[model samples]
Target: MLCIGFDVGGTNARGCLMEFTDATAPPRQLAEVKERIRDTRAPSQVAAVMADIATRLVEQEGVDPAQIESAGVGIAGQLDKTGNTVVGAPNLGWTNVPFKSVLVESLAGAGFTPPVRIVNDLAANVWGEFCVGAARGHQDVLAVYVGTGVGGGVIAAGKLYGGHGGKAGEIGHSKVVPHGAPCGCGQRGCVEAYVGGRRLEERLTQDYRAGRSLGLRPYLPVELRDVDHMHMDAIIRPDVADAAAAAGELYADGLWSYVADLLAMAIANGAMVLNPGLILLGGGVLRNTKELSRRVVERIPSYILRAAADDIEIRFGELGDDAGVYGAALLARG
Candidate 1:
């Protein structure tokens, strides 16, 4: 049977098509595609986008619709235990939508009537790693992926552990400070609010404007406060060589330490509560900035109980950008 997996996030939707002949056979990847949804908030629009993706896969690969058996979709927000209702995805501007049914209907119209199953994106990630990626063979595991925002999942006693309402493992939403940076979830003090890529960029930009002394050329406005102008040009004093070099290191260290501490706290809390056998970390932010990941890894043990934290393994996720897709596909197989 053919199965499909879709990973829908605030910025993009990625899908993969698979063919499996038997329960023991390794899945054959038939097609992979990535698309951007123009109207993420509308379930109908999202369904249409997914429908198109499925149709293209079947057609391009010369597969009959009847061969498709099931589909699993992962999303970056909360869902009911049944995984059919979108409780609330502030980033997608969606709330209480019948996502699974809507998507099934659209796919049916496109010559595919496969059953659709959905789960949180982070859950998808942890499952992928646990089954075939870095955390493979591990029964108790935790995964936190840092991207445009943060999302994570936990596995306990050999099963994916979603709390009663399926909103467990939301480490990103935990408040890091009383009234810190605002998060995309419309709240403040979240770990994501502090270290998310976009938020980090915005914070650094604001810091430079506020005179934190980074090495980048300063932007000065003639009419703006704390800005000076000379004739037609606005000028700021150039930082001395040593000061500029030191400032650059200071700026970077300042951001990394803050991010590391925030992650450490979240990891420690999750570890103390779950005591997973392994912790898998991944995503664009972690992939690109290795040292940040290193810093967090180094700082995590300090945040948790001595014995519990000592033995648990911490490793980067191995699936790269395909984690959600692989996990979703695994879910579809079930």
Candidate 2:
């Protein structure tokens, strides 16, 4: 059966139509639509955008909308189960919006109909990894997606754990410093505050401008492209490349140290408590997967019990930008 997956991120939304065959067969991306929102979109407007994207996929791909057996959305926001509303989505500038109702109505208006499921993006990400990506075959796993802000999802005992209030696996908020930098969530010392891409750039920017370090301010643009924040490399002007390389290395070092320390603590604690079989890391930061994973792995010994850590596998997420979409497809399949 054909399934539709929509990965609704903060900056943009991507939807895909896929034909799910089996566990091993990757879904075929029959059609896709990518749209960027200027952050001024209202809840209803956003719903329309999502509907339009889905409709385009069906029409462009020549697939019968009704043939879509199931559909799911992975959104970025705080969810209110009791009210069935997205309580607040700072990124989308939304609050107290009935997302499901709006989507359902929009689909109905579009003359396209199907059973649809909506979940937080992180949960969908974990589901994607567990169903067909890096965490496949594992009963217990953790998938962390590092982007503008770090986000995480946990699958325990073959099921996605969304926590009591749909706030499970908020690993980004895990405090790394007792009293460190400020975070969007209004918390201090969050792992995100320290290791998230924008913060990393800010650190480098401040350090470079202070004259306390090398005048490597020129590389900021190229190095700061991953998830809109400090990509490993972007070939640009020669001077920019040189500056970016130096800034990138400095950013990477600080990022690694912070991630290794906090992630290890979180994983080790989780290992002792939940004993996940594997931990999968992905997202923009993993653009330098080899370096990121190696550093994190090296710090495992200091955090986890030697015996428990021995059996655990720390791996990079196989799916790249497709992780959320694929996971959303998994929801549709189920």
Pairs of residues clashing in candidate 2: 219-244, 223-230, 224-230
Off by over 4 Å in 1: 20-27, 39-41, 216-248
Per-residue lDDT tens digits of candidate 1, residues 1-334?
6888899987777788887554433467889887897556478988888888888888889888778888888897789988889997766888898788888889889988767789998898888777777887788998888877887898988788998878888888888888887787788989988877667656655666565643333333325433422222322321221223334566656667777899878877888888988988887777767667777899888988888987899999877767677778778767
RMSD to the true structure for each prediction, in A, is 5.5, 5.0
Residue-wise C-alpha lDDT for candidate 2, range 111-223, written one tens digit per residue? 66787777788788878878877788899987776677788888988998777987778888887779877998998988888666666556655554453333344344633
Lowest lDDT block of 10, candidate 1: 234-243
Residue 207, candidate 1: Cα error in Å is: 1.6
For candidate 2, what is the total of clashing residue pairs? 3
lDDT against the true structure, each candidate = 0.76, 0.72
* Colliding residue pairs in candidate 1: none
CA lDDT for candidate 1:
0.76
